[model samples]
Target: MKGIDQAMNTLPCQGCKGLCCGPVPITGKEFKKIQKKVKTFPRKIRERLERQPRFFGTCIFYDIEQDQCGIHDVRPEICRAFGYHKELVCFRKPELATKEKISFKESPVGYLSIDFTWKDF
Candidate 1:
């Protein structure tokens, strides 16, 4: 199936580094599907996924050299959902654009926090 990145026509991801390729949460079924295509899951990656079965760190499939998803065709659903969407607030935080880690929290009371962390992944 075509991932959302292709469906949305977000080719090249202009003006933005591959920040979206950071830690992403996915369903157990999705992980199983991904495992079939990806071999040699790192210990750190496996631990993280064990702790939070839904979390996939640094998208093991991302091709840093190409600056795009290596497995774009069967990438996790969470990866597919990300992009220049209206509900995303990360784009506004330009300073954190090139960082290794990006996180956002939104509350019902109109409060938002964007944090960046330097993780090994």
Candidate 2:
């Protein structure tokens, strides 16, 4: 996974404005981690994040101001796998996608923006 993480760091994600960060599925463990991370955010930061307007279906944790994921370090497995797996290729860099598709070891408890919102944190 470290290799995959290193590979993902090479992606041209800085200017992408989280174009690929739409609704994502998360396992219970991932959700717990996210919740804990979100809780640690200052009230102002958390509220600002909760109030931001996102494109329909965009991820709730995507910080539009930063143009990046808010909980990136504790992001779900699917988020980490994005652009590196064959089935989750990045439109901007399809060549970076690998031949193997992502296989989830744990089933998703729910979707990020759909099933759980900022309040859940």
Candidate 3:
């Protein structure tokens, strides 16, 4: 994961907005963690993030203004695997993708944006 983190650091993610961030598959544990994280945010910050506009398929936790994941620290396994695994290659830097594919030990309970929403938290 550290090696993948290093590789992903070389990506030009700042200006790309959340084009690569879409509805993500997350486990029940991840959901609980995210719920905790979101709950920690101040009311103003939480509302601001929730009000931000995103592309049709974008993740709900995507911070459009900051152009990054709102809950990066507790992001799901698939989010961490993204742009590193062959199955989750980054379009901007495809070479950074590893030959291996990602396999989750625990199947996702639901998708972040599609199945769960701000109301769930």
The per-model lDDT (C-alpha) reads: 0.45, 0.86, 0.85
Model 1, position 97: C-alpha lDDT score: 30
Model 2 CA deviation exceeding 4 Å by range? 1-9
Q: What tens digits encode model 2's per-residue C-alpha lDDT throughout 6-120?
A: 7765767877877788789999999899988988999999988889988777789999898889998998998888887889888888988865967889999988888888778
In TM-score terms, which candidate is top? Answer: 3
Which is better, 2 or 3, measured by TM-score? 3
- Report residue 67 deviation for candidate 3 (angstroms): 1.3
- Shift in Å, residue 37, candidate 2: 0.8
TM-score of candidate 3 on Cα atoms, chains taken together = 0.90
Best-matching candidate per lDDT: 2
Candidate 3 stretches with Cα past 4 Å from truth are 1-9
Q: What is the lDDT of residue 60 in candidate 2?
A: 97
lDDT of 3 by residue, 1-121 (tens): 9998876567678888888887788899999999999999999889998899888768898898988888999988888888878989889888878759777899989887789988998
RMSD of each: 11.4, 3.4, 3.1
The runs of at least 3 residues in candidate 1 whose Cα sits more than 4 Å from the true structure, single-residue gaps closed, are: 1-17, 39-57, 89-121
